[model samples]
Target: MTNEASLGRVLEELGTTLLDVVCGDAKRSGDVGGVVIYDPLDEPELPANALVLGVGLHDPADLARVVTQLGAYGAAALVVRAPVAPDEELAAAARESGVAVLAFARGASWTHLAGMLRSLTADSGPDDAHTLGRIRSGDLFAVANSIAALLDAPVTIEDRNSRLVAFSSRQEATDPSRVQTILGRQVPEQYTRILEERGVFQAIYRSERPVFVAPLPVSDDAAQPPLPRTAIAVRAGDEILGTIWVIVPEPMSEERSQALYEAAQLVAMHMVWQRADADMERQLRAELVSTALQSGPGSLEAVRRLGLRDEPAVVLALTVVESAAEHALPAQLAAERKRLADAFAMHLTAAHPRAAAALIGDVAYGILPLLQEERAVLVATEFLARVGSRLRPLVGVGQLARDSSALARSRSGAERALRVLRSGSVSRQVALLDDVHVDALLIELADLVPRGDIPSGAVARIVAYDRENQTSLIETLRAWLDHFGDVAEASAAMYVHPNTFRYRLRRAAEVGRVDLKDADARLAAMLQLRLMKITDPGF
Candidate 1:
């Protein structure tokens, strides 16, 4: 029911519940491109017609400056925290810039607001526009708004576990607890606890009719009394799908109650349709991403379908390093992979609407629509940081691909960088192709060498001498080379006296008939050691 063609549609959908127009015209003619958060310290490049959230800019003078700046960049609107009393300067800026100034509602979270805005503007095609009973399938916000219109009261659809799925507008008409629920997208534990104590949930689950709950007592002077709730369990045949909860001042009449009972049926159908459609979309997206990365005949078509046809982008490959101690079961590992892939997709989408991520085999690949390789590196690092150290994820970022056809090359670069990380040659969890180019090359070269080739030249002679005489010459040479000929550090690393290490180094040079001072000879020896898998484990 809502389109992103104008700022008016956003206002109409959200209403005065979560946002209020503080200044300028709400019916501005422009397509809302994307949602961006404003940071005074780091002024990010604003997308055209962007809805910028001025999270902490409250000072009138500062807000006025930002408003003009965003206007110059053609931002559709700027949202600051609520209670914005427009000064003369602020009002004049909004009028001259034609950038609508909106206020975020008190007690609502910026994350929730951003999420709602992004969902409204996400790119979609005809397949995603399919409808069930006039409401777009899988569009829960629209469904919630429709249900609210039917009941003439605010309502929320939640899962069996009491987690909020979708909620209607007019949330401000409810109590503080309801606002908190909307903000967190979940019922507070204290409220859920009270419901459990009173057997409210059990009653709703057990009955076929709507269960009416009386208002809860105020815990303290500051806490508002919770509004009464009328809840009905949504079901499909014998399986209970979820529940629809309406905030009412009192128990509803028979006709209104019947309306809610019937609404549950539609809600069940929509929920079922949403789940099926989501699964299909995920599978389709995975196929498209795979095709695009293959750089074959269908790659261009796949890229077009993915909305990344002419975009310069970067490819990122992510995987979990196996832990021997965990010895994770196959099923558990598969589930973990799916979970991480979904989270990765959500993270990338939130950062950039055009970004696409999907799990291809065991690795999750993400294509970020950005021309700057360094920014992609930063994005990957932030993702890893959010994932934390538990999964021990390694992300390999590739150079910028000029367009759809170049995606395969970027994917190759990413795979090579990932190979370096997986080979344990570097200790970092995230790296770009350029950062690990040498290590990646060495790994590739090792693959070309035959398994039985072993070490050659001076290194081979030293290895033979060490084997026959049980000497420390080979260790001494490796240590000296690894430490860049720093005798004290090399000796310390080998846990031997500096003079002893020096003696062994001289002996190794003599036995191998190699000149230690020759740079070319040292490079040859190092290459041989690398190819022999002596400097690192097998690639």
Candidate 2:
């Protein structure tokens, strides 16, 4: 395991940019366990020595109360919005509880702060998690800060797609556009459009040297003119990995330009290292998730390593329906599956920081740390809707598992629910096991019966008659049963006249020697028809 980061290290990295100490000695607070957001109405369980974000808690009394509570939980620090005026009671509470108090900068975002802290605190193997030259390898925040220090200007690192990766301190000193980028974590679309129209991005990507851009004119009445920017693309061989951009007043001198070019090389190295580390960690997590789901001899240890030992969670099994890519090449399907799995992992993390997801085989499994099955259903539905119908995504949410030991059972339930969906018994994309219990039971029954032989009884006779005479008797009977013996609905479903449907239904009953009026007889026919439909769609 990698060495845990101390609260002092967190302050050392972020203090110059985002945080201000209010009370307690951070250096003495030791290592922080993880970052957690404080929820007032429903407090989530905190890991030991957590760094808690006290969002929306402004009152001194409330702050003091939270500080005391966090201390009881052995939290390292409680960060509230600045500028905090620590009263005597609050100071006393902090002192008594031995919990350090910190203030989040006024303009900085809680989301960004949480993300930065998580990056610093997330677990990793020792080999890839260590520092290089006083800064953690692959730590974009530290790289951006170092670049800003060298350039004496605000900095923002962006991926090739123009998505913000990390930013330096003193963003408030930059233009309104920069502030907007920091707040949204993305360059505004209008700004990107203007750059694209001006061939600014093309120029930056095409050149290895620093490219200087003039200030953008005000695009709207309320918009401020953006400051001039100097950008250099970070490339690995022929591949452009990302760009490093600095807010500058003018084109740089030759020496500083050389420094910026050198910095791009460093940034490229970090980006590539981060990508490799991410792949390794993803594989490691996949193995742990697989082991935990098996509930085998190593399951307990795996669950502990995953930090989900005692947590109540729901298992969500997500897979692409065959109809979405039935004719696609195997490589294309594999790529799509991996893409969906990555997106699912990100979505789950955004939903709950403690949640874990991984792609196992063709299906992506997410362990959503939620208390309610209904909430899991809602989350799954929202995810499928957001992912759209391109893959025709399907998610099966299992019942809530109250602890780690129950996860295997929950996974089994989710798999059963997924099977029901894949068998085309249900029309909806997202389902809970409880919602489709009957269909799942029917699938289980089909599995129990032998696969080769035709189903027996009234449905078997109907199938044989259809095969022998090319009759519509099986279709007619299935439609009637599906419509619960409604002649009008059944006929409409089969696209035949009600009189014709009635005639076919009577002939089916006669050929099978069945009594339609008998409830037991009708029930038997319905069961057999369902089993056959599930086992053999052509029947």
Candidate 3:
């Protein structure tokens, strides 16, 4: 095995626990091959996987700046001793830069700490060698067992989200926290909240060392005493994958802590491997969804591959407004869009198991089985409700497709409805294609209408007369047609006297040279004017 130590082991040996983890808790699994004492005047010559800096860094701002620079140099972690506690700004910068921030106790010996770290880096134990070899052989269980045996403690491995991935087999020695985490496959939200208030997670994220958390007071009437725990971050480079937590009654010995740190490195390797496999699966699913959206010969085959071939389906589209996109950075916006898409897909899958959702560009598209048309509306409404006021996204639902062939048509209809929703005429969060059929139909036929085909002269003459005289002839005619040519109702709608409406109608007829007495002519005029509003850019 390689003779290397982690920052966590070094800190434990130096008798200093983590103060606050600004960022890079996941990266604490990295090996520490050397140590560097930082001098501000001189340029840093950091070695690979080197732990840098030491106590006597008094100013938080200056310390934060140095931490940032060390992060850029790819340092494993920053060791500092402050006269006063570091401020939040320093912690925030360290987090953003993915550098682990470790603060020693007040009046701690920097020289002794540095010398101890150097000596530790020069030694490697037989058990450590065995664990590292097992990790490389893809035996994560062996690594976990080794750490549990060495520390004589029950251990649990959890992903960054606190979801349990692996655990030691020492069930009898496990505490309530380990049992709860294993049973739920995640840390309980109540426990998570308590830890957050205590800054445990903050320390975990920023520290490249093991963080010891004391038991918290129980709120329940039959409250049980909390167990003490030692947790180390599992990381690959600057990317944190998970954490290895040991439930112990007291602090671990230096030898045991060092072994635990080595085990974390192995766990990080395992996590990286698992993530790579997951990424591959995600990419394949994205490709399948992309293929299903097309109308080519093999599109139905693609749908079959995703196991949604025979189900009645509809397409749903969600789009973020330009204003929201403008306010966020490109990277932040992209990440948000991805998060929304994943959330939508998860909800869709939960409701409709055969459904598929994907984010293509700024829009999120879903092809879900039409179990019930109302359910589609419910799903869309629920998604909007969950999003609430944060995104203010517009949603459009297409008509149901009875078969795969019509899937493309459903997608087209959804796009059409989305266009109408984007026009700002609808006040609701979701618009269905059926609800906007008239506008959709007019938009579809607008391109097919030939120039000067029918009633163009009458429409042009009426429009010119209204524009030149500042009158409302077109509005009156539209209202009359809408009310089925009811003169009294049209007059009421226009807020005009009956005789004034009649006079305007007559003038409209005279100016356009149209015979309003003919039902065919009246119907034609109404269709033309309505189509004009939809198709004409100036209108």
Highest TM-score, which number?
Answer: 1
Candidate 1 has which clashing residue pairs, if any? none
What global local distance difference test value does model 2 have? 0.83
Ranking by TM-score: 1, 2, 3
Estimate, for each residue in 1-539, the C-alpha lDDT of model 2 and write its tens digit: 64346888677656444788898756755567777778776565777888888888899999889999888888888998998999999999999998888988777667667767777776645766566556667888788889999999989999988878888877767787787676666788988999999999999989999999998867577556678999999999999998999999999999999999999998888888888888888898899999988878888898888766567899999888557446666776777788788767756665665788998888899998888999889878867765634556788989899887888988998998998888888899888999999999998988898876546877777788889998989888889888989999999998999999999999999989899999999888888888878877766
lDDT of 2 at 135: 68
lDDT string for model 1 (1-539, tens) is 23434688778667777789999777888678888777675555666888988877899899999999988988889999989999999989999998989998887767668777876665544655777768776667678888899889998998877777778888878998787777776788998899899898889989888889898766678567778989999998888888999998888899999989888888898889877876787899999999998888999888888766567989999887765356666776777777778767766765665688889888899998887888888878877776633456788998899988889999999999998888877889888999999988998888787776768778889999998998879879988998999999999999999999999999999999999899999998878876666344742
Itemize residue pairs with steric clashes in candidate 3: 21-203, 21-206, 21-207, 22-206, 23-206, 26-235, 26-240
Per-candidate TM equals 0.79, 0.78, 0.53
Model 1, residue 136: what's the lDDT?
70
Worst lDDT window (10 residues) for model 1? Answer: 530-539
TM-score, model 2 to reference: 0.78
lDDT of 1: 0.82
